[model samples]
Target: MGKLQLVNIEKSYKTGNSSIKVLKGISLEFRESEFVSILGPSGSGKTTLLNIIGGLDQYDAGDLVINNLSTKHFKDRDWDAYRNRSIGFVFQNYNLISHQSVLQNVEIAMTLSGVSNSERKARAKEALADVGLSDHIHKKPNQLSGGQMQRVAIARALVNNPDIILADEPTGALDSKTSTQVMNILREIAKKRLVIMVTHNEEIANEYSSRIIRFLDGEIQSDSDPIEKKDSASINQPRTTKKRDKTSMSLFTALSLSFKNLLTKKGRTILTSFAGSIGIIGVALVLALSSGLSNQLDVMQSDTLANFPIMIDTNEQFVDFSELGPPGSEKSNSKYEEFPEDTTIYAYDYSESFIMHKNVFTDDFLSYVENIENELPEEVNNISFTRGVGVNLLAEGTDGVVKFETMSQNSMMGGFSGPSMGFSHWYEMPKDHQFILELYDLIGENSRLPEAENEIAIVVDEYNRLSTLFLEKLALTEEEYDVTDFVGKTMLKLLPNDVYYTEAENGLFTPANP
Candidate 1:
C-alpha cells in the first residue's frame, strides 16, 4: 500500500446560476520517502488539490488516505491532529510573521503540536541550520532577503518532523541561484522524508523529483515514475539512494550550530535586524492604532446611533490642518490637514447623517472611505459642489461689466441649460456689435468644456501676453491681472445684451468684458 492515496475524487462549486466542476474522478498513490512533483499551468487547480491532501481544505467527494489513515471522514479535531503530525506545508509567499524572530517563527509548528519548550527550540534551531539560516535566528522576516525568508519558512515546516512535506510553488518567488539552493535542501530532506511539491517550472521539478505527475483541468494527465517498486522480499531493504539510517542532528547540536553561525557575524546581524525591528515596530503601532480607533469608533457609534441604524455621531472630530495651518505647525498639523475638502470625511457620528447618506453613496465609495477613515483625520464632513455655466452675481458698481455667452443650438435643443453642459463650441468667433472680442483662443487644441477651466487657463502661444486690461487703460502684470482669487469669491450676475457681472464678496468690480 502507498503512503498516500486519493481515490475517485470530485470537486465542484456553484457559479452565479450554474455548477462548475473542477476535478473529475481522480485517483493517485504516492509511496513514502518519494520526491514527487505536481506540474501544471495556471488555473489547473494544483493548489486546491494540494490543499485537500494537506488537510487545509475538504474535498467534495473523495477518499484521501495518508499513512494508512482515511482522511475523508476525519472531523475538525482529527484534521488538526493529522496536519500537526502527518503533514508540513511551505508556501510561495513565505508567510512568516514579521513580528517574530526567525527562530520563533520556526518553533510555531512544534509549539502548536505541544512539544516541550526545550525540544521545540532545539528542533527549530537545527532546522534553521539545515536551511542555512542559523545566523538569522533573531532577525524578523523583512530583515532577511527573499531567499532567506523562504528558508525560514522551510525550517518552520520541517521543525515538527512531519511524515510528509507539501510545498506549493516553493521556489516560485526565488531567482535561479536561490531556487537551486532551496531545491537541493528539499532533495536532501526527501532522502528520508516524503516531499511533494507543486510547481510550474518543469526543469526544477525534473532535477529534484524522482517521480513527476502532470495535471490538467484539475485531473491527473500523466504519472511518470523513475524508480520501480521492488518485490515483497526486497521491500524492507533500504535502497541505495535512500538514506534512512542517517540521523538528523539533535536539538542541542542544532542550537549549537545556530549559535556558532550567529557568532560569525554578530554585530552586523544585530544592527540590520535592529533596523528591521524598528520598521516592524512602526508598522505594529500604526496597525494597532488603526484597529483600536476603529473598534472605539464602532463601539461609540453603536452606542450613540443605535436608533439611527446606519449613521454614527461623535462629540469631537479630529482635523489635520498642516496644509492650512501656519508654517511652524506643519508637522504637528499634518495629521489633521491631510483631509481634502473635496473628499467626504466620515466619523463615528451618533446622528442621522450616517443613516441619510448610507444609500446615497455608492457601495464602492463607502467601502473605500470606511477602510481609511480610522487611519485619517475625522474632521472631514460630506460636502459636494455643483458647477453651472451662469450663477447669480451681485456686482459692486452700478456700471459693472456683464459678460455672457448665448447657448448653442445643440445645448438648447438637448435641454442642457443646467450645470451639466453637453454641447461643444469653437474658438475664433466673430466680434459682436456691443462686446469687443479681446481673448478667444482655445486652452489647447480640441479642448473639452469641463476640463477647459484647468487646461485652457493661460495663453501658451503668446509670451508677455496681456491677460487682462484695466478701465484705466494701464497695462498690468500677469500676477496683478490674474482673477483666480476673484473667481472663487465672486458670483455671476446676468444682464441684457448677453452680458454678466463678476461680483466679488468685497464689492470689487472685475469685468470679464470679453
Candidate 2:
C-alpha cells in the first residue's frame, strides 16, 4: 500500500468578504519508493497542496490518510509529532538561520526530537558529510555560496532521517550546474524514501523524477503514473502503528537560539538594552521622587497635628449617621409615606448639608500660625515641637530575618498619617522619673538605660517572664537556647524606612533593588 493517500481533499480561504477555493476535490497517492515531481504555473495551488501534505496547512474537507490512518482528527501536537517524525522540507530560499553554523542548522530537527547530544552531533556530521560539505560545517550560511547553502538545507532536512523529503523548487535559485548537483542528491535520497519535488523546470523534472504530475487550476492535468482507487471499505481501515512521542523543543535549546540571535546583532541588542534601561530608570526615578514626597507630606501632617491642638481634614467631613432612618430608607424630617404592600425601598434619596472646601494649610497660613504662636498669652503652656521619623528593626533568626518597629508616635494624631509600625507592644521609658526608681527597687536591679543609637532594653513583667508568642515570632524560644545568652549575643540591624523600602512599578514597596 502507498504510504500516503488523499481522498477528495477540498480547501478554501476567505479573502475579505469572498471565499476563494484553493483545492477542489483533489485526490492523489504517494508511495514510499518513488520520486514524484509536481509541476504547475504560479497560483495553481501546487505549493498549497505540498504544504497540506506536509502538515503545514490543513484541508477543509476530506481525509488525509498516512500509512492508512486518517489524519482528520489530529490535534496540534499530533501534527507536530507527524511533521517531526515523518516529514522533512527543503525550500527554494534554503531557509537557513543566518547566524547559526551549518552543523547547528542541521541539528535543529533532532533538537525537537529529544535526541541525545552526542548522537545528534554525530548524525549532523554524517548528514553534512553526505552532502560533501563536511569541511564547511562550522561556517555560517552567509559565508557560503547559494549552492552550498542549499546543500546545507538538504543536510538539515535529512538529519532526522525523516520518511519523506518535500522539496519546493529546490533548484529555483541555482544555475544549471548547481541545479544538477541538487537533483542528483534528491535522486539518491529517493532510492530509500519518498521524494516529492515541486518545480517549473520541465527538463530537470523529467530527468530526475520517476513520475511527473501536472497541476492546472487546482486539478490534476496529467499524471505519468497514478495509483488505482481502492474500495472505500479497504481504504478506510486503519492499521495499528507504533505510538510516537510528542515533538518538543527544550527550553534550553530555545534560549540558546535566542542568545545566539542576540549575539549576532550586537549593535542592535546593545542599543535596545540601553534604550530600555533609560526608560526604566526614568520611570523608577519619577516613582521614587513621588514616594519620597508622599512620605514627607505624611511627616509634615503628623508634625502639624502634634504641635497644634486643632486638626483639619481636607476633602473630608465627619457625618453623624445616627440621625438617618433604617438602612435603605431616605432620611426625612417628616414621617415616611406608606408604600404598597410587599414593597420595601432598597435605595435612599438623601442630600448632605455639609459643604466640601479645601482645608489645606498652605505655607502662608502656617506663617500666620507662627506669628500667632509668637504672640500667645503666658497662661498657655509651651507647645511641644516634635518630628516623626520611622526606624525598621531587623534581626537574623533561625527561620529567617525578623523585623520589628515600635508603634508610631504619629498614630496619636489619627489613622490618617500613621505609618505601619509593629503591633503596640513597645513603650518608651520616661527619663529621670520617680517611677524608674520604684521599678528598680521592685525588680531588685539597677540597670542603666539605653545610651547609644543601637542599644535597646527588653523589659519583662513583674514575674521576670516574657510573652511566649513574641519569643516564638523572633525564633528565640527559651527551650531552644538560654535566653540570658541571647541578651548580649543577639544583634539587630536598624535601617530608616526610606532605606529599607523602594516603590515598585505596581505602586507597592519591595526591598531596595530586590
Candidate 3:
C-alpha cells in the first residue's frame, strides 16, 4: 500500500449562496519516495488536492489514509500534529515574512513543533546551507532577489525534516537558471522522502518529476504511474501509534513573535494608546467635578439650617392650592373638570389672596411628640412650646399710665402671622441662655433678652425698625434718641392677666382693685 491514499474525496466551496464543487470524487495514491508533480490549469483543483494531501484542507466526503491509518476521526489537534510533523509546504510567492530574518523564518516551523532553541538554530543553518543560502540567512526577505527568496522558502520547508514536501509552483517566480537549481535541490531531497509538487510548466514537470499526474476540469485525466486498489486486509492495517508529545508552541516563543510584529508597526501602536488614554481621562475628570460640587452643596445646606432652626408650629395651618392656576392668573379651575357632576370644592379659588386651614394637634399627640424629643435626643435638639397669649402693655407717661397695643398681642397679629407674614410667633424669653447669647450678638450692648419675669427684649424686624407708637410710649424719639437710653427704663404699672382681672359670677370677667 502507498504512504498516502485518497478514496473518492469530494470538496466544495460556498460563494454567496451557491456551492461550487472544486474536486469531484478524486482518488489517488502517492509513494514514500518519488518526485510527483500535479499539472493543471488555474482552478483545476490541483492546489486543492495538494492541500488536502498535506492536511491543510479537509475533504467533504470520503477519507484520507496516512500510513494505513484513517483520517475520518482526525480532530483539529490531530490534523495540527500531522501538519507539524509529517508535512511541509512551499508556495509560489516564496511567502517569507518580510520583517523576519531568513534564519528566523526557517526556525519557525520547528518552534511550533516544540524543538529546543539550540537544535532549531543548528537545523535551520544546515537547511539554508543545503539551499545555498548560508551567507544570506541573517538578511531579511526583501533584501534578497527573487531566486534567493525562493531558496529561503525551500530552506524553511525542509528544516522540519517532514515526511512529504508539498510545493505549489515553487519556480513560478524564478528564472530558468534558478528554477533548475531549485528543482535539483527538491529532486535530491526526494531521494529519501516523498516530494509532491503542483506546477503549470509541463516541460519542467516531465524533466524533473519521477511521475506526472495531469488534471482537467476537477478530474484526473492521466497518471504516468498509478497504484492499484488495496485489499480489505490492507485497509484494516493497525492504526499508527499516537505520539506522547503533540505539536505545540511555547509561551515565550509566541510572545517573542508578537512583540516583533508590534515593533514593525510603531505608528499604529502609538495611535491606539493615545486614543484609549483620552477616553479614560475624560471620564475621570467628569466624576471628580461632580463629587466636588455635591460636597459644596451639602456644606451650604447645613449652614442655612443652623441659621434658621427647624420648627413645628402648634397652630400650624395650610392653604389648599391644588386648584390654583399658574401664578398671576385671574381665576382658579378644577383639575378634575371632566367629573363636573361631583359638586365638592376641594381647593380655594385662585382669585382669593388669603386661605386658612387650621391643623390643631390634640393633647395626646402633643404628649407623644414630647416623649420622642426626650427619648431621642440625637434625632431632635429640643422642643419649645408657646401658647397664643394676648398681652396689654402699659407705661407711665408725663400724663397717666398709657396703654400700647404691642406686637406681642397675638390677637392683633393672628390675621397676618404665617409663612406670608414671616414673623409668625411672638413669645417671651426661652429657658435656654443660648437665646440670650444670640440676642446679644444681634442687638449689641444696648439691649438684652428678658432674664427676669418683669423685663422683655424689644425685638426689631430684619431692617431694625421699631413701632413708632411703642417708641413714643417709652418716652424716646425713634429718629434722635439712642437705643442705650431705653435700657433699664421703668414702667409705672405692669398688670398681667392675674393682676388686672378677676372671675365674676357666671364666668364673666371684671377689673381688680388698684
Candidate 4:
C-alpha cells in the first residue's frame, strides 16, 4: 500500500503544428484501504491520469510522490523496482498470455521476483483458490469464458502481494453478472489496501466506493467523501502504508518463466531451437571430415615406405678383425663379382639399408617369422620380409658339378660405415619352392622357376657360361649336347663344412656337421 500524491500534475501530446494539453493542473492525495473511483467520459484523460498514478507514464511538469518519496528523485532502476514490486494492474482486456495455463499466468510476476519454484507454486495455488478457480489451474485462457479469464487476471495481480492496485475499466468487457463478480473481488481487496478504479458507471461508484472523484475536461469536477452521495458504502477504516519487500529479477527466475512459456507453445519452441543450432552442427561436421582425410593420407604414406633393406649374413660366431680400406669402406666379396657380361641385377630402391647378422635361413626361421607376423597389429601388412637377397649356387650341369655366385646391389647411398661383426664358415639352408619362384622375376631371363626340386635355373648368360665351364671340364662337344634348357637337369646342393643344430623333440640339441 502507498500514500500516493499528485501535486499540480500536467501532461500534453504534440499534434503536428499544435500541442494538446491532456491533464490540466490536477492536484490530489490518496491513502491506502480506500476504494476510490475516478469517473470520466472518453478522451477526458481518465486512463492517462491512472497511468501517471501507476508509474507507467510520466507527467511533464508536476510532482508525483509515493510514501513521502518524490518520483522526481527516482532513477530508472528504482522506477523498475517500484513498478515490478509495489504496483499491481488490472486491465479491461484480462491481459492473460494466451498459450499459458491459469497457474503459469498467475506465477509470472513472482517468478520474476526470484521466488523459488516450490514457494511460487504454493502461493499461486492459494491465489487461484481465493478466486474460486483452483480446479482450472491447468487450463488455458481460451478454455475459460469471459468471467473466468477476468478472475484469472485478478489472481495474477494478487499473486505478487503488491502495495497498490490500479484498475482501468477492469469490467468493461464483461456482462453485468460477471462485472459484479469482478467488482466484488476488487472491493474485498480494497478492505486491506488501496484500489483506484477508473470507470464511468455512476451506480457502481456510489455503491462500492469509499470516495468518488469525478473529472471533466481533464480537471477534477467533484470530489465526494461517500457521506455526500446517496447509498454510499465506504468503510471507515484507518489507512496505513505497508513496508515493501526489496527483491529484484534474477536469471534463474527469467529462465524458469521462459521454459514455462515455451512449454505452452511447443511447436514454436522447437523451430526456434533449430534456428539457433544449425550453424554449429555444420561447423562440427566440417571439422570431422578434415580429420578423417588427414588420417588416410598418413596411412598411405606409411604403406608406400614401410619396407626396409636387410643384409642376412650366414656366418656369425667368429670376428674377422681384418681391416680393409677404412671403417666405412667394406671389401666387396668375390662371390658378388661381376659376371662375364659385366651385368647388374636391379633389386630394390630404399633410402638407407641396414645389415642383419643371422646364422642361416632354415625351416625353423620360416615358422618363427609366421608366428611373429600374426602377433602384430592388423595395419602391419608387410612387416615380416622385404625383397632383396644375394644368391650363391653350386649345381650340376652338362658334364658334372660347377660353382657360381650372384648378388643384388643398391648404389643410391655412399660413404657410410658398414656393420662390423663376427663371422663363421659359410653354411647353406633349405628353402621353400615359393621362395625360389619369386627370384625368377630378376635372374631367369623372364623364365619360370625350376618346376622340379632336382632342377635349377640361373641368369641367361650364367646358364650359358656354366654350360661352357662344365663342358670344358669334362671335355664334351657343344654340338652333341643340348644347353638350351636346364629344367630337367640334376643338382648337387653342397653345404659348407660347419656344424648346424636343430631343436630335438626331447628339448635337446642335435648337431649335423658336413
Q: What TM-score against the true fold does each predicted structure earn?
A: 0.45, 0.59, 0.59, 0.50
Give the Cα RMSD of candidate 2.
Answer: 20.7
* Model 2 poorest ten-residue lDDT run: 411-420
**Per-residue lDDT of model 3, residues 189-266, tens digit only:** 889888999999999999999999999888999999887665334764536445524788889989988998889888
Per-residue lDDT of 186 in model 3: 90
Model 1 lDDT per residue over 369-473, tens place: 555434553532221122233332233332543333333222221112222232222122211211111222333344323332222122222342332322112
Tens digit of lDDT per residue, candidate 2, span 199-294?
999999999999999998899899998876663346666654546689877788789778988998999999999999999999999999999999
Question: Clash number for every model?
Answer: 16, 0, 0, 2
Each prediction's RMSD over C-alphas, in Å, is 27.5, 20.7, 11.6, 19.3
Residues 470-491, candidate 4: write the lDDT tens digits.
4443344464544444434444
Q: All candidates' lDDT scores?
A: 0.64, 0.76, 0.76, 0.68
TM-score ranking from best to worst?
A: 2, 3, 4, 1
Higher-TM-score candidate among 1 and 3?
Answer: 3
Worst 10 residues of 1 by lDDT: 429-438
TM-score of 3: 0.59
Displacement of the residue 161 alpha carbon in candidate 1, Å = 0.5
